[model samples]
Target: MDTTMSADTVVLLTGGTSGIGRVAAERLAATGATVVAVGRDRERGRAVAEEATAESAGTVAFRRVDLADRSAVRDLAAAVDDEYGRLDALVHNAGLASATRRETADGVESTFAVNHLAPYLLTHDLIGALADTPGARVVVTASSVHRRGSLDFDDLGFSSGYDALDAYARSKLANVAFTLELAERLRASDRADGVVANCVHPGFVPSTGLYRDVSRRAKLLTRLAGLVPGVGTSAAKAARRLVEVTAAPEYGERTGLYVGGDGPEEPSEAARDPETRDRLWRVSADLVGVDPDWP
Candidate 1:
């Protein structure tokens, strides 16, 4: 942990109350940073903050939020900036999987709304704060399953057919594409030297609550998979991977990288395609009603 960096830094981490995110919160705070942890569960969020305060050189603060709501997302961004003024890292660790298709309060698909659109809009609203902080980063918790995803803009909501795993994979693909595009934009902008964006694949972590909304059979199968030898990722290990990307020096300069346990590597063909990345960024901005061009 970079105690000096952590002591001077401010990190906004969503889904900080659970799974790898929960562990990462404590770890990040231990590095001596003021970590603002966001999640819907007030108790868990507070508990994380309390634990981090007790165990680490740094500290954590909890905020309750429903990322599915656009207004709430905007308000959260506003509050973060109003309080912190500058942001060292914006970590999108929050995500979900749904067995059946549903729409958010904003009428966007629930899975896409929470996993992709929420972060997209939040980033747009916070890029200025990030640019003000030297060596700031945007760390997205993408997944390796993105290779199996199809980003069909016409069917983004999966109205034609919906599968929990497929929807989750697609959302992660969007995360990767968004990171790639955002990195390019940040690099070309006046704030290019300060802000960097990257995504990480934490591997198959069936131990997390991410699959809580999946079908019963899927849940049972996930549990069974967890019992298998070396099949499931431990929350502790995954959180370390997240911590590495969030605070490690190597990532401070690198942008558009998809980091995994092995380190930075190329992502799926679809994710690497400039056409797909640009289209996703533009479409995401339209869905969130933000300007396509940004830092």
Candidate 2:
């Protein structure tokens, strides 16, 4: 994955301070793009920025943000829009997994709030900025596990029961649905010159910290799986997959692709349904207090 971004390009990447995201941030920065790495840990975020800047000799700025807070997501978008004026790429790589059922400050499920709604609201706020830049792309980090998931608009919070793996998969399913829907809407928009939106299943990355919040049994399984020669995707490999989707020519030429282990592949049947996509868009908009009709 020796992909490169053009000089002066600006990319806003969520979850950029750690794990696969951190490596992706460095890789993007190495391409000469101003990579804005958003995360919750200020110290860790700043450290990554400093180290990546030193290693890549490129800019890697850090922004502390709690994606579960709707207000914070809004503020982050506003700040990025004001500072950059135009965004070349927006990557929704931040995700959440909780061992127990938890609600965010916005009264939404933690996993759903961070994994899905944050991207939904942030994209709503930044769509104008994205539209400002011709050829801008939106790449989301989804998972293949979404095939095992189902969405119940009435029960997005999983009020009936809670399982860490199940919740994560559900949120990932939303990621795919949102990416596909956004791409379609962008196509019809008059301003949709070259903006593309796609999601990639980064494969089963057992080595990433994404599963640290899962239950003991799940964590143990991930650890054991990581021991396999090639069962679990390394953070660096996963980052490469992310960068390919973000800056690759093929991805820019197309829209609404779901790339998994074998490059572009069909997502779950539920995710490809137009009705499901529309409903997810509307419900997500309602959840985040935004109008469903968007660019």
Candidate 3:
């Protein structure tokens, strides 16, 4: 870990209203980093940021954003650029676990839109600002459940059929693919030297609102899983791994890396598949109207 605090470094975190993002925002803010938290609920988002800033004795602020809207994400990026002049880190932590299939106003599936496309679009729009700062980091929160997800590009929007679990898993898988591919693309470009990208699985953190959409019985089962000696852990514990990944000195040279619970474990077979990663990058760029030139 760097163990060095710098107030000048700014971290923009999504889904800062609750759960892991909430804890992370506070911790980063406390470390003298300026934290700009993004969430849909204005009250909750502001409260979280305020609490974080209060606890850290550092700078923390909130911005209301429904990431599912592409234009909103663009505006948010513009606002960040204007306010901060540079974005040092971006944590794509916002996510949703919907019980039923729903579509956003943009005609994209809600799960895919919120979980994958929003972050993809946001990161792309802010890449210039991040590259402007040397030694900047991009940390994406992924999930171990990505192992179960097989990308079906033709039905990416869950158009033909949709299962909540499958859709969620696919979105998480997209996160991994996006992170890895982004790392590859950025590493080869002028941005490679300073702006590094990485992704992580925070482990099966229980009571993280990740199971809020599941049935009561399912929630009970998840609670039970965490209780099983060494199972689903606390969000605080999970956040440590994520925080360390972003701030650690050891990772300074390793970009496009997929990290697991115990340091840098190997990602799933699917996550490491170069072909799948490339294809997902193309499809995601097509969906978001960004150039697939990075591929």
Ranking, TM-score, top scorer first: 2, 1, 3
Error of 1 at 133 (Å): 0.4
What is the Å distance of residue 25 in model 3 from its true position?
Answer: 0.4
In candidate 3, what are the lDDT values of residues 1-295, reduced to their tens digit? Answer: 4633488888899987888888888888878999898988888887887777777857779999999888999899999988898877889989887878899888889989999999888888888888897777888999988888878878888889878889989999888888888888887886544778898899888878878997677678888898998787788988887777777777656788878887776777787789998898888788889997742
At residue 185, give the lDDT of candidate 2: 95
TM-score of 2: 0.97
Model 1 lDDT vs. the true structure?
0.90
List model 1 lDDT by residue over 33-123, tens digit each: 8999999998898799898889999889999999999999999999999998989999999999899999998888898999999999999
Model 3: runs farther than 4 Å from truth?
191-193
Cα misplacement distance, residue 194 of candidate 3 (Å): 2.4
- In model 2, what lDDT does residue 19 have? 88
> Once superposed on the true structure, which residue ranges of model 2 sit more than 4 Å away at CA?
1-4
Q: Candidate 3: what lDDT?
A: 0.83
Model 2 lDDT per residue over 1-295, tens place: 4443776799999999788899999999888789999999988899989988888856999999999999999999999999989998999999978999999987899999999999999999999999989789999999998898889987989999888878988999999999999999998998765689999988778867788788899888889988898788788888889999998777877899999878999999999999999999999999999999998
Better of 2 and 3 by TM-score: 2
